[model samples]
Target chain A: MADKVLMKGNEAIAEAAILAGCRHYFGYPITPQTEIAAYMAKRMPKIGGTFLQAESEVAAINMVYGVAGAGYRVITSSSSPGISLKSEGLSYMAGSDLPAVVVNVQGGGPGLGGIQPSQSDYFQATKGGGHGDYKMIVLAPASVQEMADLTIEGFDLADKYRMTTMILADGTMGQMMEPVELKADAVKTYEKPWAVTGTKMARKHNIINSLSLVPEELEQLNFARYERYKQIEETEARWEEFMMEDAEYCIVAFGIAARVSKNAIVAARAKGIKVGLIRPITLWPFPKKVLCDAADKCKAFISVELSMGQMIEDVELATRCKKPVVLCNRAGGMIPTPEQVLAKIEEVAGGIN
Target chain B: MEPKRVSLFAGHYGSGKTNIAVNYAFLLKKMGKEVTVADLDIVNPYFRTKDSEKELSEAGIPLISSAFANSNVDLPALPQELYSLVERQDRYAVLDIGGDDRGALALGRYVPFILEENNYEMFFVVNFYRPLTTTAEEAMEVMHEIEDACKMRFTAIINNSNIGNDTTARDVLATFEETEKLSRLSGLPVRMTTVTAQVAEDMKDVENILPMVLQEKYFDINI
Candidate 1:
């Protein structure tokens, strides 16, 4: 076991990125997520890395695009509103197939909603917040440990697929502290053959841009990207099933909401109700197969979220309407209590058998 | 024997003071004392004693915090009811002070009343792993800074040296030597060395050890 240190989620993510050999960080300050930038600012200088507080999220994400195109590991983090400003740049990065890690420490939103934790950015994150029809490999971490682990994984996945990867966490997870063991120094694995490093006299020049004048060429590019997405969906869909073996009802949640639902499942189980939890660690791939498998055994499902039932749509789609799916949630920065979730589980279980 | 009535826990940021304070409150309450945890933290809005309102309340310990606590607002809205706790000589009170000199200034307002009314022990909690207080001299500097800001003196030093969740018995034992150095420099006795409860059972031979139940809201998903 490596040396474990108690770390806040945001700070842990930043340090993990550094440990993952991400030498360049560019980001704007936003609440609940400012710790990432602050940690980068303090440690990056000592470690001989570049940490720039960009003028805006737009400028910061564009800086990521530039660094990533040059074949360097780079990262940028923001809250909901700040992420909104970076969408265009994110789309540009995806269109150009540049590998970069973007962290969305989610907060309540439609506008500058609140600084408290919320899962309201589900649609914006997994469903392509940017303009193009591109999907980010969205990893939702429920703990401070996962915050560090997934950040390292996010960089690797980004480089593996040549696409932008996101660590979608909320304010609760960002502020919360837990013990985390950081990854030790390792050799770099993925090769960036398409990187726009300075063209030496021996090799052909590499062009990095999102522009293709011909519509046919752009259509072919989209099809190729979709093929990569298909591969990702097939292989990278990850989730955790708790007490799901003999469950009559299943609770679907992710991130902070999953933590609450786990408690609710325990409480429900104590009362002789066979409630289980399916926590999706990877939100983009949706973990549909596991949910479908649980749907076969469980008579009912409840989608517990910090948002107003955004992930429930995915749950319904995954189950194919085979079982009744209900929403047990708190929106606009409110978190559901274990008792509230337990009541929902009991209510759904009442209709099960 | 009667329990200690007024205990103040002060520390630097990320020093694990809040977790110690919460655990101490539970300890006192479990001993059948009338306990009240006053949230004197005006610096950090998140991870304060007020965030454990439900637990504290259910444990029969009243939590006295600012009105705007645990919210996005950063205003220091200290409640007038906190002064009444100072007047009550019957109950055991734990003052969970905020981080650093800036946070200690809030305690200055009640210094005269606390000094006049009751027997109090203001504990300066020190974590060796935290920045700025990595050494004994550096830890003494912070202790003096808090004393100057609060217009009161810390009676003793509490060695709360741990690197968050990664702390072990060895980590707690390693700080004992530095804390002795800190004791000599500050002319204050090392009251107790605190470690998480998980590590405490193995470190039984260590003197002046206070095992604290972890109160941090990591909220693990056991899946």
Candidate 2:
């Protein structure tokens, strides 16, 4: 077992990306997420990796596209507003089927909100921030350890699916510190037959681009991407259920909200409320089946989020609105306290009888 | 001997000085001393002594921070109450200085008063794993820079070399020779070494072991 040392979430993600064989990192400095770029800038050179501070988030993601196209592991990170700027580049990567890791150390939304921690980018991350029928596999990490673990997993899943994978972290998760046991440096064996590395008189030259001018061909490409998405939804849906045995009410959350909801569930259970929590690790896959199963046994549901009920829509769709789904949220960089979430749980559990 | 009236912690970024300061404050409180932590870290907003306001308050230790702390605003507005605590000689106070010479400038503001009234020990925390201060000479240079910025001399050094989650006992001991060299170069004593609680238990025979509670962030609720 590796020794445990305390590290902030942003630095942990950077270290994990390096340990996952990521050699190229391109990112612009943004509040709540700048530590990642700073860490990479210092460690990347020492480890013989490339760290480029691009002029803008747009240039950073496009640089990631260029690196990923050449068959090397690459990454880029930014906060919410910077992520908005990277959308066009994200769309190009998705269209080209380039495998890369993009980390969203999410802050408050819409416009330049604030530098405080926020999880308001749920829809933007899971629904493809860029304009297209493309999807990026979104992994929501609740702890600093997961910030490291899921980053490595994000890289693996991106290469496995030939798509972009995002570590959807908010300000709190990105800034907090925890003990993380990083994985050992593993050998890379994954094949990248579609990489646009120089041909060198090889069998054929490969081209990487997202522009398909032919209408029928574009339609066919969209269909194939959707098919892969369907497979991911079936096989890659990841979630964790806590104290769900004979739970009469369920609290659904992800990321930092899920961490707070766990405390709320414990408090509620101490008072014999019979409430449990369902934490979605992969937001895009949505973990609909587990939610539906809990919906059958639970009398009510409370979707705890750091936004204005963004994930609740998925909770509702997952359960088909079979049971009442209430929302307990604080948006625009405000975090809901455990007491606040417990109050909502008590309210829902009170009406259950 | 009586405990030092004031203990100040200064270090580079990622040196884990904030964690050491928090743990030491609790240690003083547990000894039945009136303890107060002044959060002079106006540079980095992410992790600082101010983030543990609730914990400190719960432990009956008052935390004095900047006015706009833990917010998006980067104002270096120090609370007036800190001046009173620094003036008081009855209580033990821990001043958590921020990273780099820029952060040490916050401590420079109280230099005249600190030098006049209080008997304080400023600890220069050294973490070899950090990029800038990787060697004895580099660490000594940073100490001199911090002293010049804060207008105060460091009385002791704390060896806190550890990689996050990848730190080992060997990693901590690897810096002992260099830290000793640093102590000799700066004419300061090697005060103590910080390690995680788990590591501290196994290496109890090691002298001057400061067992640090891993308080990296505010949120502790993990499911």
Best by TM-score: 2
Off by over 4 Å in 2: A185-188, B1-7, B19-38, B51-64, B74-94, B100-120, B126-154, B159-187, B193-218
Worst 10 residues of 2 chain A by lDDT: A180-189
Residue-by-residue lDDT tens digits, candidate 2, B111-170: 898889759888999987664577888888778888889999998899988876556787
Docking class of 1: acceptable
Candidate 2 residue pairs that clash: A5-B165
- How many steric clashes between backbone atoms does each model show? 0, 1
**i-RMSD values for every candidate model:** 3.8, 4.3
lDDT of 2 at A8: 74
RMSD of each: 4.5, 4.3
Residue-wise C-alpha lDDT for candidate 1, range B24-95, written one tens digit per residue: 889888888888999888766477887788889999989999988877664767899888778888888999
True contacts kept of each: 0.35, 0.26
For model 1, the stretches where C-alpha displacement exceeds 4 angstroms are: A185-188, B1-12, B21-43, B52-64, B74-124, B128-157, B162-171, B174-189, B196-205, B211-223
